[model samples]
Target: MAESENGATQPQQPQQAPKMNVLAQFVRDLSFENILSQKGAGGDVQPDVQVQVNLDAKKRSVENQYEVVLKLKVDSKSKSNGAQLFLLELDYVGVFNIENVPEDQLHPFLLIECPRMLFPFARRIVSDMSRDGGFPPLNLEMIDFLALYRAEIQRRQAATQAEASNAPTQ
Candidate 1:
């Protein structure tokens, strides 16, 4: 209850922070590698970065938290000397609480928001590592989370519809 302008008592707003029935920020996996390739082991050179990103979401059995893992593999070789400069593999993860969320919402949260949060940190690591490793920094291309999420959702829905159509008639 609250006091009104005229001194009348009124109902008060409810207390307690809104329950975020979603995943909080967390890390499921992280790896930074600076491995020199076979060709560059004995030579001086810069690595050509080839970055591959794989995204997926899985539920944790006990706590019900979802783990979104972004696997990045960077393969680089020297342009001048044709030597292996650095082959970096970064497996980044964002732990999200996904309780009480619908299936459609879950996909968006994992594909878009989770990756958006993790990308900057991962980008910094890759850039800094190459800079400190005696080579030009590698700048990764920006990821399109919206497109990816839509594709995944469409793919899942299609599969679901197909399965339903193929079911035995009652």
Candidate 2:
């Protein structure tokens, strides 16, 4: 409550600092596959490994809080022989409490920042799974989430433009 200059009482807006909190995090799904399981290591199989990564986020509003779930998928294949050496898929979820952030900025923040916070753990899981599956430890390099986000946006824009151009003109 605030008092006006004329001595009349009035309601004041609540003050809140911008904040983001991780309420909880969990692995919703995980899968690991070793395609060359039957064929034991016979010779020096120089691994021609290929890796792919993808990210997604969704916001769930529960009362005053928001839950941001980050979904990630990683796949590895041997390019030399076109065999999938290993495939890893994981859906890591994070429940976040977001406050005071502008609507325009929320989407980027959720997709970029939240995934950054979750990547190390996911990387560890991938590394461990590869080693435990009787292969050398896979040390995943750091991901550039911002660059990835930008690329995705550009791709979407290009696709939209292509669709619009292909539509029947009025």
Candidate 3:
């Protein structure tokens, strides 16, 4: 046991970082609504879908856990006459337990890995909703979340640069 000149006690050994662990992970909530197609579509409907998806992730806590929400909307229409076929929205959220991950680097795991993990389940729901809405068993294609996120980042960066350039020289 030794004390420094400032009268502060020092440990004989260096302290180690906290150990991380995974606690729990599962789908918290899911919803698929075929509101329009369920009510208005008729037989002999040959439809084309306009699909859109959005992904978001957040660290629910610092204790190695997070939440990611995958949202998709499909607006299907008859190709021949441009008549409305069906409008469906699928919003699914999944909770993930990520442990031992550094704070600064957790973003990629959220924007990239978490969404990637949740896509398949979300895709299945999309297809099933279309089938359950009186159409054939739909086969929704896979999505590239990394590409989407990169594109968004690029767009934002360009906009910021442009704004900075356009700002009055002061």
What are the TM-scores, per candidate, against the unseen true structure?
A: 0.60, 0.81, 0.73
Residue 39 local lDDT, model 2: 53
Which pairs in model 3 have colliding backbones?
Answer: none
Q: List the residue pairs that clash in candidate 1.
A: 1-12, 2-10, 22-97, 23-96, 23-97, 40-84, 48-77
Which ranking of candidates, highest lDDT first?
Answer: 2, 3, 1
- Model 3 compared with the native: what TM-score? 0.73
Error of 1 at 93 (Å): 1.6
Best candidate according to TM-score: 2
Stretch of 10 with least lDDT, candidate 3? 18-27
Cα lDDT over the full model 1: 0.70
Worst lDDT run of 10 residues, candidate 2, spans: 38-47
Ranking by TM-score: 2, 3, 1
lDDT of 3 by residue, 53-143 (tens): 8877777755566777777878877887787776777667877777566678677667777777777777777677778766776777778
lDDT of 2 by residue, 75-105 (tens): 5555567666667777777777777878898
**lDDT of all the models against the reference?**
0.70, 0.74, 0.71
